[model samples]
Target chain A: GAGVSQSPSNKVTEKGKDVELRCDPISGHTALYWYRQSLGQGLEFLIYFQGNSAPDKSGLPSDRFSAERTGGSVSTLTIQRTQQEDSAVYLCASSPRQYQETQYFGPGTRLLVL
Target chain B: GESVGLHLPTLSVQEGDNSIINCAYSNSASDYFIWYKQESGKGPQFIIDIRSNMDKRQGQRVTVLLNKTVKHLSLQIAATQPGDSAVYFCAETAPLNAGNMLTFGGGTRLMVKP
Candidate 1:
């Protein structure tokens, strides 16, 4: 792809339902990151992936929130038992070769847990 | 902990005036910094970046200044315009072994009034 790509630009789900958001990073990018942006709030770090490593999952908000990257290309973020507080925009980014290198962002997926 | 996407303190500037956005980073080891601009419903776009080795860097109508001594960073926009109204984010980069990863600061919103 020409840039980082995220899917399902907008979503509205019932409370307690599970939702999965997808991300397709730029080709050959080695670092991928996930962030949550709430209304009028700062972007919150959610998770990070470096190549095929264990990933830096320190930012995951809870047990119900999880993410995974396959073959170092595509990724998915799953939120189980969605809550109203979970409504926000999920942003994904990826950098070429290194982590601190420039990270290109995606359009993001906006989720609304009703 | 390093983060990005600020709660967004806002700065309003009249058209043809200049706007300055400020940030403070927590990591002393972070030497590389980049500024991003995000419009409503859009992902952030890279504005400018400065290396720790340099105190300043300039681009078309935009400049980024780094004060490592104070752990502060600022973005200056010359001749502000209504199109410049957007949220600005400052990010710091840390060397992580073979890669460098960015930790973002809270964002600041710039409103250019015509």
Candidate 2:
């Protein structure tokens, strides 16, 4: 079975630039999540989407970060005016259901803001 | 703030030995726990998960144990192999939350010595 997939495995951008990371969730998955992994740190929850419900944006670091799940299948995480602190791996995951379900992850997009 | 954390940052064991990774969570309301393994250049892969109702769950060569009373979780790998060397993370989620967002702990780097 095809797993969750992400695009732009690696991205390098200048400070203050905008970047977009894409994720393709597995077929039939209704829940998608975005997370960030910093060096020597744990996975930080970023945003979440379940079906067509309002996405949870509480985990996002700041106003510059936003994500949209289109048609309940694909998601795009956008960071506007990126900062050096945003240099990290952006990971995506999806699950069959929203509650207490095993999540499949996609190889993250490593973003580097210089 | 409540969060999941690992006691040890790294562990090394001989090949074929049994390895156990421990995690401590602060949210007593958490009812689901999961373990994930990540290689150097890859995203995290689900290893196993255990519900608060169960104390343990086993998968192929991995076992996940959850202790709701103490807010603790552990992942044990039987006959650990070099291929198992990677960073292991434990995550928890409170099913009551609508988002069911997972809070991940600092990863434990497992090294299997040949």
Per-residue lDDT of candidate 1, residues B8-112 (tens digit): 388988999988888888778887888989999988788998889999999999999888897888898999989999888888777752245456666888988
Off by over 4 Å in 1: B1-8, B96-101
What DockQ results for candidate 1?
0.49
Q: Give the TM-score of candidate 1.
A: 0.91
True lDDT of residue A81, candidate 2: 98
Root-mean-square deviation (CA) per prediction: 2.4, 1.0
Per-residue lDDT value at A69 in model 2: 88
- Highest-DockQ candidate: 2
For candidate 2, the iRMS in Å is 1.0
Q: TM-score of each candidate?
A: 0.91, 0.97
Candidate 2 stretches with Cα past 4 Å from truth are B96-98
Cα misplacement distance, residue B81 of candidate 1 (Å): 1.8
Q: Is the docking of candidate 1 incorrect, acceptable, medium or high quality?
A: acceptable
